[model samples]
Target: MEKTTKHPKQSFTVMNELVLPNDTNTLNNLMGGRLLHWMDIAAAISAQKHSNRIVVTASVDNVSFKQAIKLGDVITIEALVTRAFNTSMEVRLDVWAENIPSGTRHKSNEAFYTFVALDENGKTVPIPEIVPETAEEQELYDGALRRRQLRLVLGGKMQAKDANELRAIFYKD
Candidate 1:
């Protein structure tokens, strides 16, 4: 799963504001929904750079909130396109939160998101082929391939009813 890259071809940036009292539920912590929204935005930016077209979230792989982000902590999201398929790209995002007063930073979350390039009519469109320029980039590409395989397996095992339900959640008109 590793390919060598001399340099990175594409990159995208996403900024997240700190959690506020209003942004939190009664737990005094950031809500999962809010974090997901930020991740979606960051993934879209990365996917658009790889495709050079409008992109929509096809699915989100496993997302784990490893640490809690508190109020006054700035969350910075960095996303890179690790792999590309015929009409889809896999973006890996690193979510880090920085405390303003102390300048301390910590990784709060990470996730892989699948995005498909879209045409004006909302059909799938082709995306550029990703060529790894560095060893790290190649490793990321390879890891994405493995993840895609896992996703396929999971997709295949879904019961008809559950598959339909998942489709409904993702493809609502």
Candidate 2:
């Protein structure tokens, strides 16, 4: 039996971390690797919640480090399942850095992570579809297909000729 669709809010996850002395580099800024690890965890949690099964990270979109997060800053990671395909889900993450001393927060950047759901036997399984509830959710939901097609084309899993959504971007009738 097919499962019912879920709203994106049902899978939203938020994570917070503090940058300590050990988490900083020579310039007193948080290390990129550490931030990536936190993002991965947040994204994985979101995927798991949406799928209700174990998930493995299949790919991560290009991440741009917009601003350097200084030490002693508070980092907040917000994650949500934008869309779920047959056996994989795309999780969108937004990272923010906050300086408590100055009460300033910056919208760092956003990235996408793809995860495939697996059953007890480690075999891929279908995931529940997502129904966007708000305008923002709907936009993300609609754009997810194009992003997926782009990823497949770039990953060599799908030929450019078969990427209809992606082709529509460059070529219009």
Candidate 3:
């Protein structure tokens, strides 16, 4: 049995990986693709925990590689579901790189991943709603819709005119 609603913290997930030679490039920095893969897994786990059902990657928002993670650094990925719609949930991921030997840590970046819950036959299934408990959680919960709308517009799944939240911010009419 699954609950009808869940708090964002309930689905918090943390994953760590050591950047090995295979995960880095000639510059000795962790490959962007490898970091993306790790983020996807962490976010999927978080979304699945929130929905209590299998989830598929619906979309990944813009991910900017602000800082480079070097080889041998421990990469910690933290993920949690910020909001849940009818059958989809928005997961926020925070990536950090830590050099344990040097005792230094740096933030890589943050990204949003959307996941849709699926049933046994691979059909979309309704998921639990999200209840934001903190002010920060509430802010993320509020922004998720705008971000989702932007994604839909860019993907051609939705029209620009239909994005009311975006319009409110940009048009202001």
In the range 1-173, model 2's lDDT, one tens digit per residue, is: 11223354448888899999999999999999999999999999889889999999999998989999999999999988999999999999999999999999998868999999999999999989988888998999989999999999999999999999888889999
Q: TM-score for candidate 2, please give it.
A: 0.94
Candidate 3: regions farther than 4 A off: 1-10
The superposed Cα distance between candidate 2 and the true structure at residue 167, in angstroms, equals 1.0
lDDT of each: 0.78, 0.89, 0.89
> What total of clashing residue pairs does each candidate reach?
6, 0, 0
Q: lDDT tens string, model 3, 102-133?
A: 99998997999999999999999998788888
lDDT of 1 by residue, 21-140 (tens): 877767677788998988888788778866779999888998988988887678788778888989988988888989889989999899999999999999998878888888998988
Model 3 weakest 10-residue run by lDDT: 1-10
Lowest summed lDDT window (length 10), candidate 2: 1-10
